[model samples]
Target: MEIDEKDERIDKIDQILNDEIDIDVNQEGEEAEFSSLQDKYQINSGEALNSSDIYRIAAKESTRMIVLVGPVASGKTTMETSLYQLFQNSPVNDFCFAGSYSLQGFEQRAFYTRIKSKGNEPTTQRTSLEDNQAFLHIRLWNRNNNVISNLILADISGEAFTNHIGQVDEAKISFPFIERADYVVGIIDGEKLCNKKTRNSIVSEMIEMIRTFWDAELITDGCVLQIVFSKFDLFSKVENHNLILEKIKQQIVARLSELFMDIEYYNVAAMPSTIDEFSVGYGLEDLLQGWVRKHVRKSSRKMEEPFDELTEYDRLYYKFLGELNE
Candidate 1:
């Protein structure tokens, strides 16, 4: 009886969502198709950091695409906002902020967190799942190398990652940028990792996520995988902090060591707690410096080409066939 009731409720919700979508399509035009949903709902659409502009920038210079993956409330937004604010105001190590294509978009995400309430501490609003296509763009100028590089950081809602956690094929479909990403940042909530009850779930989800990436070939041997423990300020206060960190390494990192070649770990306190509002973004600069170094030094993921496997005779045959077809 409970299962039936649950199914009925799901059916009702599905119907309502379909109805709303139909209404939206009808209101727009008959020419509007279901495939256009991204354009209609994606936050990047008609914004400064839209896909078209980012692609154009990529064509001109090599842009390091880093995708952030984590569960809901894993501090993805907070890290992004804090990083943006830091880049805007301060110089990270030696790299100076050259410019950004999406300054206004950065402001939109960072503004709310900067606001302070009289009685209550300000919280960063959850990044909506609807805005999957949006990315925060940061460009840095290296004084030592005299090279300018752009960092395209993708922030998909944590719910998206969790929803497709174990679904390997579905994860490939959902996270299309994984194929082109230079680095994958697996953001885990440090506070949750410290809690005994939640630790298992977090570790399980991360393991599954890594499996999905490996199975889908989105992450290969050479690709860099970064495991970040966010909200470390809270986690550090716990008495069993060392034990929790060891567990994470043993359970999560040790288990997946075979799948990736270069795996790095970092702990970050991205935001200030109510008690230490003045010390905002403690331990975040190190993370940013590491990220920037990767962006500057890491090579792009090499795509496997079929021609590499072809024999000399087969190559000639294909060339002849191509000429005939032409």
Candidate 2:
């Protein structure tokens, strides 16, 4: 009896939706009829949004696209994996999250080929294939006070940002997908930064690469430049390593500010290997909690400043320049 009632309810809703669509077709020349049908459709749409009505409303209005960018071995993939593990099977009451059923990484080449081949055709797939290594794109849904579905994620290649690609031209490179994102994640290797001898080389390369690839508009919008410092455990060495970390972060922030004054930064910790100990999961709650408070906070379950916001060396150089000017 319960099943029958559920089927009946669905049937009635379908019938109403169908009837309205039909009315819209027939009312083509009649503005009044079109308006009436629109109102009816919107009312029915409201019912589909579920309980945490506001979140659903927000999700629809703003489909969040997470763009993960970083160097070849900066643990971007590891971070993606950890994030997926957190929200994958978690239960939520009302809405279904839109994500790849498989835990996969995005393949950029394949995605570009497919999109370009389509040549303006509409995709039948709810989410396009090769959409960001399967970990960079996500579509989320909210239900009651709980959230459901891990949302889709896509991760692009690190090579794209390694070289001077124009901002507008770079936007075109990602095309339709770039058009979809509301957030971004920039992964950094903290282990590398905390090493004074290697810090300058990597940090400078990352800044140049950012300009060579990535879009400036991406810099402007709800784009949160999450500077996930992977392999954070490597930085726990001694006093000097701590000093190195702070200096490098400030340098990066300064470079970004030079380009566009509005960019935001973040630190992310990821386990680089499947090894025991020196892992990143302990006391991860605080990290996840902080992530939830940000502009692009959502999950299947989980999860800066300058010179004090760039490098101490950069500051010293500036001071040197001041003396020269004097």
lDDT measured at residue 133 in model 1 versus the true structure, 0 to 100: 46
Evaluated at residue 195, the lDDT of candidate 2 is 64
TM-score against native, each model: 0.72, 0.51
Report lDDT per candidate: 0.72, 0.48
Model 1 regions lying over 4 Å from their true place: 1-50, 116-119, 274-278, 294-326
Candidate 2: global Cα-lDDT? 0.48
Model 1, 116-162: lDDT tens per residue? 43325545667778874477788888888887888888877788888
RMSD of each: 14.4, 14.5
lDDT of 2 by residue, 1-326 (tens): 99998887567557656775344444444444655767666632211121233234346544344556666666555555554444545622233345532322333222322346564521112232233323333344555545533333345455554532455565555534543444455666777877668778777776765554344444433344555556666655546765666776788777765543235554555443333545443223334433333343221111122444347675555444332221
- Report the number of clashing residue pairs per model: 0, 28
Model number with the top TM-score: 1
